[model samples]
Target: MAGREIVLAEKIDLHLCWEGKQLYLKPIPTFLLHHDFFTHAICTAAAPPGSTTASSDLYASACGFLKSYTKLIRHESDLAIAQEKNLIPASVTWNQWCDFSADIVLNTTGMILSQRYDYGELRLTRLNLLYEMHACEPFHWGDHRYKFLLDTISHEWLLFTFVYFTVVLTAMQAVLATQYGAGSVGIQRAAFGCGVFVLVVAGGSCVLMGVFVWLRAYVLFFSETWIGRQQYRIYYLDRILEALVLSE
Candidate 1:
């Protein structure tokens, strides 16, 4: 009974692990990567290979992952962790290595592809969009307010045109009210109402726009503590953005 309970608990843990990471996508992530579970799994004895070939032959399925890592791996720590010196005891067999690599590459890709628009794809799309807008990495290394303001202000001619049009319209309405209002009260009231409506709409829009900019700016620069600073970043400001993607 005790043995059965222990087995059940482990199976539950394993299920939880896979379930947690069944969706999120990120670079070099794995289910048990860097966890004590990983250490325990590696410490277990690996079954012997079918052939008499050297252990290197076991890595046939994992060669693709190795090639990709060799070419695109950005972090030296990843390489260091996979070294033979660090993988003592039972170490990782070819099966384990393949599983690890699959979890990082294939599983992540599959999850992203299977996800709905508002889920994984949405977050990844957001991340990519932000990546294009960013001048540098880490996503929070610089002040982006100037860039946004300058980018918008670059279209100042349009705003100037709108303002000029509104001013002229208001002036014309004033003329209509003063010159023709007594002759036709309806025309005068219509002109005055039109001018007031336009002003109110335009002014309200400007105020709302300004408020939106101010709020976004505040959010961008928020976070007093070091941990708070990571809230917006560290996986693209989405829930579970860091949940499993931050692993490995």
Candidate 2:
């Protein structure tokens, strides 16, 4: 059977060998990836069958560590936020942290598995790794608040236009009210009352629009952050599965 076919097979446990050691190979933990269970099945299928190899023990241990890691960083919790803020090492960029974690997991797993397997340097290729990394990236907003606002405003042109018109209308009404108060218009009392009413309505609309924009930006940012966290987890899991499948 082809590699992908083997991965999708039903009798996966029949193929996994835990190094003849009595180590308990745990079931795959829940991950943030889209097809997480399928990925786990692939890992199980790719493991060499009926071998008392040391590589099996290493693979099992690595899998255990990964499960624990996922639990510790569950969803977009405080720990995840803190890690995003400060857990980055000097050797990697902030955005590259997930990719770096993948490298660590895959390299470590591959190095252990290669002890008995005849991979012959047929490890997971850089091109495939880069593709997976790029594919799992979260949607990025610009760094600065002003840039984020500008980008959001550009995308929300309709709402922005409405806000802009209201502000312009308010300014015009204020100008008329001032002119009438200065006795420049013949019907001063009537013009002043009309201008004041228009000013109040226009000003109120501007304020409401401003609030809407603020709320929209805040919600979008929060949602993106949550999605980004999940994507990072998926990227990590993908790398582990890729290493196992490609090495096999």
Candidate 3:
């Protein structure tokens, strides 16, 4: 809580690195470090080595805060402001700050001030942050051209195919009309019935295609959410282990 204590906490050599989209926290290995009496007391109060009994819920809540916090931080200036407000540490860059803050808080207080903040306020904050991040990034049309082309074809292909078939059917009807000379009533009736059957088949095919697309999208969404939850659980366990090692 005091400035001296905060400074001491910062003195611990901790670093964050990214491997793909996953973050890893590196600390001085346990065998190479010497701990003082005060450090031992702090670590004991935080959590026991190899156990997260007291810190489990706190760590989970802190992780949610860290993720939302990380998403909001997009620039050096934003990071500076967060540091000024003591929301994050001054020692790290924006990219490295979230894990550091989470590590420090979970090891010390196991509490976040934002936990008391309103949900609506947090949602609005995240929305504003997202807009700012999007606005700051440069958009390149060339990078998205392939995606645009694919989407266009996906949305219009059914209509285009239907139009092609309709044109062919119309040409066939015109030929029948000319050949029959408008006097063969039975042939005309048979031709009309065949055309109706073709229309029915085409409409059924379109309906089936629509249902298939909807199901595919639903499955993809469900799979992504399940995978994301699993990844987050792994990340949380890793962070807890890293904190335990550092405390040692």
Candidate 4:
């Protein structure tokens, strides 16, 4: 087959600010409506005639909107992580925090690289998630509820596994039916098919549920288990940021 140019039709750049911190984004913006872009785009709209910049209020409003947006996102993200944390003992410390941070950063970076390299999409809607992935090095990925809900919505992994196993189960049912003779088996043939289908769906759902639970655990106990491992990484990152700030 011939190759294609592959222009970035869905790409967008966004800037979010809160508590004096700013995060820049270059992500696909297909999900947003024109109204949704109003906050960030207002910076351009508020510019005075013949001027290159907008008024402070526009920027301020953008920041305000960003703060609200961040709150909502973090709230949702924290839900899963919080549930996981609730399961852990209350004696977590600084060493545990560092180790958790290191493990998550390493694992998440690898996952991102692997998925994006193969599938070519990083579809986190909120900028804070990227920051958490890149900057905070959070042990908790997000709320566990979101994992299952989003997977169902996107059918990203769960759907794929379900469909794959469903087909296999159907094939197995058919083979067994043929071996036993569908006519001779009568209603037993239908029951076998139904059972296979039910088992496939049930098993797949259980497995998906287990994966989400594990992800929740990792996020919840990450600080407890891995912060000690991340001491050097945190130190280096802080030093680099300090150097950058000083240079600026």
Per-residue lDDT of model 1, residues 52-98, tens digit only: 33223223212322334433333444344334223212344545555
* Candidate that would win on lDDT: 3
Candidate with more favorable, higher TM-score: 2 or 4: 4
Better of 2 and 4 by lDDT: 2
Give me the runs in candidate 2 sitting further than 4 Å from their true place: 1-140, 150-189, 235-248
Report lDDT (Cα) of residue 65, candidate 3: 41
How accurate locally is residue 208 in candidate 3, as Cα lDDT from 0 to 100? 80
Q: How many backbone overlaps does candidate 3 show?
A: 0
Tens-place lDDT digits, model 4, residues 13-54: 222221112222232122221344653664344444345443
Alpha-carbon RMSD, each predicted model:
18.4, 20.6, 19.0, 19.9
> TM-score: which is higher, 3 or 4?
3
Candidate 4 Cα misplacement greater than 4 A, ranges: 1-48, 54-128, 137-157, 179-248
What local distance difference test score does each model get? 0.41, 0.44, 0.47, 0.43
Better model by lDDT: candidate 2 vs candidate 3: 3
Candidate 2 residue-wise lDDT, 13-34, digit = tens = 2222221121112232334122
* Candidate 1 residue pairs that clash: none
Q: Candidates sorted by lDDT, descending order?
A: 3, 2, 4, 1
Candidate 1 overall lDDT versus native: 0.41
Q: Point out where model 1 deviates above 4 Å.
A: 1-144, 149-171, 174-182, 223-248
The lDDT, on a scale of 0 to 1, for candidate 3 is 0.47
